[model samples]
Target: MNLKDFKAKLKNKIWRNVKAYFYDQRIADSTLVQNINLSTAQNQKKAIVSYVTYSHFNDWENNNIGRTQPFEILSMVKVLTELNYAIDIVGCHDLKTLDYLKLKNYDLIFGFGETFYQLTMLHPNAKSILYMTEHHPNFTKIEEQKRLDYFYDRKKKKANTVRTGNFYWDHHMKKKYTHVITMSETEPFNTEYTKPFNIFPTGILNNNFKLKPKNHDSSKKHFLWFGSYGAIHKGLDLLFDVFQKHDDIVLHVAGFYKDDRQLLEFPNKKNIIDYEYIDIQSNQFLEIIETCTYCILPSCSEGFSTAITTTMRHGLIPIVMENTGFNRLNELAFFLNDFNIEYIDKQLKEYSTKDSEYLASLSEKVFSFANSNFSIHAFESKFNVILNQILKND
Candidate 1:
């Protein structure tokens, strides 16, 4: 390995070891085990699960992309608790804990993302469920592409792309789990799970995002590409190119772009406004949302775009590509044919000419849709129904 790459690997190894050591200590706490197992005496069903942590639920700190894990987990816990179910939380990071717990004995096993598949598989008789975060296979392809690009740029010999397949890649995991649940709007790509795949939409705090007076002039209407990290993977590269070509439509770019210097090349000139990394809860966030008629996210893949939904809650319509994983993009928003720059440009141009009255009507439609679909009430109702279904089928 090259000196730079070797140093990077060594640094990562040290960091991982450090984090692992602290996590081991945290899980070792005696009170931690008892607290999760606590339940009402009348409660009948007791579930044992692992991997999901309180830190996952803390949205403000994690800066979660969408479907705040804490809210989703807490909502599930609330439903289970109300049903008189005792939940024993287990930390999946430590193999010792898994061995000690005997996961199969629990009435239900709750797991999130791919790793839990193996845990569930180990306990064949365990009544388990997997709550997948995204369309994993598609996401993997993107990661693979990025790795290959890095290798190519470095002029490395025999640039081999490594495919690190996770639980999402394994179709058999479908049969392994009792049933699969996802935050995604549609069925994941290349899936063999014939059983019930429940689609539970994510919840958004109603008070956090409210409709504000927007600039009514259609001619001056701009778009905001609110994203985080993974700029290239999120298709910000394509967005930058597209925005540079179109002077008529102002595209305001927001969010943290890590290691992607291409954004620096496209100065905040022409019709582009680069407001890098503003707090979503800040007044500045609302101000930018108010100025824009549409929130553009031509993402390559997503389990669900929280940015799109959050913006819609503030009454900005969605302009997205097909595979954004948000199924509700039908009549309420505009869909790009592909992630091509030309297609995005064409779509933006078409949207730019839309009159003020039409934009106002569209905004109302989007707002109503967001309120009905993305609210906490809607989330709870759907969650309760799914919980009932899971129990009934079990």
Candidate 2:
């Protein structure tokens, strides 16, 4: 490794270990019934959001580094407070056991986790909302396995499946909810829940990125694959297979990969550039944004990828797999109807051959669409409407 890359990796490792130590210490001292109350009045209606409370515990304003969950969680609390409801926040994964007696008096239970499931069962009279951030667990499990099997068939080696559902299988089994809110298409949830589902667009960090002029003729041959974790599940392996064979096409990869060996297996391909982990706010990401014309991900499942949306906001025309919760974006994106190596290779080559004018126009459309639909303001407004409907039982 080069000196610069080696220093960055070492810095990241040290920071991660330090952060984990403090995080674990905080968890050890945390209490079961402790909550962050946001009530304007004493007699306001009470609601409990069983999601990430770490947003409240940290200096989120300054240390906003990864994912949109922290902002989304804070937005949910803000909406609940504005609705005249006293809100209590809990970390979904932090609790080993919940105090049922202490929580039974809450008028509403929202978000997803084992605690959400337990509360839904314990208080049948409460307004329970299941916030699904992914495809139904069954769908996710089956699809991830399918990708793993496909990888094994091609490579003659096994890789770990990293995209397994966070919520247990039994969380949805035979459970009824007052309303179901999702960030993706609702069709996948049909197999798991009979309840009505409401959809909201996932939010992206608007870095206020300004689009710059580019030579689409040159950039069109360059593609980007940006994601976090679950490299195989996000179809990075498939991308490696396609780009490595065709030196004419360049694939720029960003994001964390847990399986280093999976990366080592396909090393030293001149056509592929790996920028391991990237911050969207960094100059490295901006340089990549300027270099690539298309952002591609063939992920097996998603609840609307913010990764894709973020790239779209930066004027990268999206080329994504069909039915991976991107059906809503079909008009703005190029959809791959199949996931096989032959199909991907055929489609990508066809896409890269488009004229510069055509590529630029499509990129503008994608950027405008993403800015209109996937902003934090858009997410908050849509979520507010959904929450009101649930509260009023409309």
Candidate 3:
């Protein structure tokens, strides 16, 4: 093995150990081994909800794109707590297929993305809330060509896995829940299609998105993208080319991938700053966004990027690509760009936060836009509306 690879491997091992040592599980140990039969408590004005996430604890902070479904659950839990209900969370399925958790006593589950679909089969009596990201056979059809692909530049990866063989994807045995939860009136998700879908986003602690006073070299502007880079939808390869021709500009990356990918080694760019492996979907990620100059996501596909909303919260000017379920791309998106380098470069020169005047213009509007539409209170109000309605009938 190469020396660099060996050293990086060592660093990864050390970092993993460090995180395990310090990352607080925040879970009460008393709740761990007890037999939790939520079904028995079924109608007690309390709920025992189960969440089946697309990701888990290891990836929750180990990589740059890492997020915590637990934190999201906790936010909803806090809301439900105020409403006088209790909830429990466990991995959707354990390593062994036979060990899946299924009991018919829970009230509702707000499961995310692909994991929600499979987990629904486990609890037929419980409400199955499918909160999914954009994917094939769901949002954009294969016929929408020339459009960018979110999974590693390949159109095939973004295709409907639900329709593929042995995928055995089905929803017949399981019935759709009365409520489907999602955020915004955007792409990859259409409230029209999934009626009674509630728009509930995670609430942000203001300090996390509060900006600190710092010196700015208004002349040396930066463009930003904060999300996972494992796939091409993040437009990293496109940035490699953009950096080649522009020596004055810089790129700030955060959200996923610990090390710079081999494809992002731009020769001419002054600097490439990376904030890898911060627990975003967790509560910590908001702090990172507040500290950033501005955040951008040129994703080829998205239902609604968590980073995009978080960035906007902290007054980071965002640049976005128009794609699946990205419909609410209103004032939140300041400088939108196509994936091609030439058009991007031209826009960057004109619109980037390169001067005090330009920064001032954007700064004035940033926080207000986020507060009005992206606050936790707003999320709770909408979500509770649905919960109240459901309970009224039940």
Q: Name the top lDDT candidate.
A: 2
Q: Which parts of model 1 are misplaced by more than 4 Å?
A: 1-43, 55-67, 90-96, 136-175, 188-191, 200-209, 218-220, 261-270
TM-score of each: 0.77, 0.87, 0.65
**RMSD to truth, every model:** 7.9, 9.2, 10.4
Candidate 2 CA-lDDT value = 0.78
Q: What's the C-alpha lDDT at position 193 in model 3?
A: 42
Clashing pairs in 2: none
Candidate 1: worst-modelled 10 consecutive residues by lDDT: 155-164
Poorest stretch of ten by lDDT in candidate 3:
159-168
| Model 2 per-residue lDDT tens digits across residues 73-167 | 77788788788776667666545556534544778988887778877777778888888787666677888898889988998877776777576
Best by TM-score: 2
Q: For model 1, how many clashes?
A: 2
Ranking by TM-score: 2, 1, 3
> Candidate 3, residues 234-282: lDDT per residue as tens digits?
5665665566676566776665553434433434445565656555455
| Model 1 error, position 52 (Å) | 2.8
Worst 10 residues of 2 by lDDT: 27-36
Backbone clashes under 3 angstroms, per model: 2, 0, 15
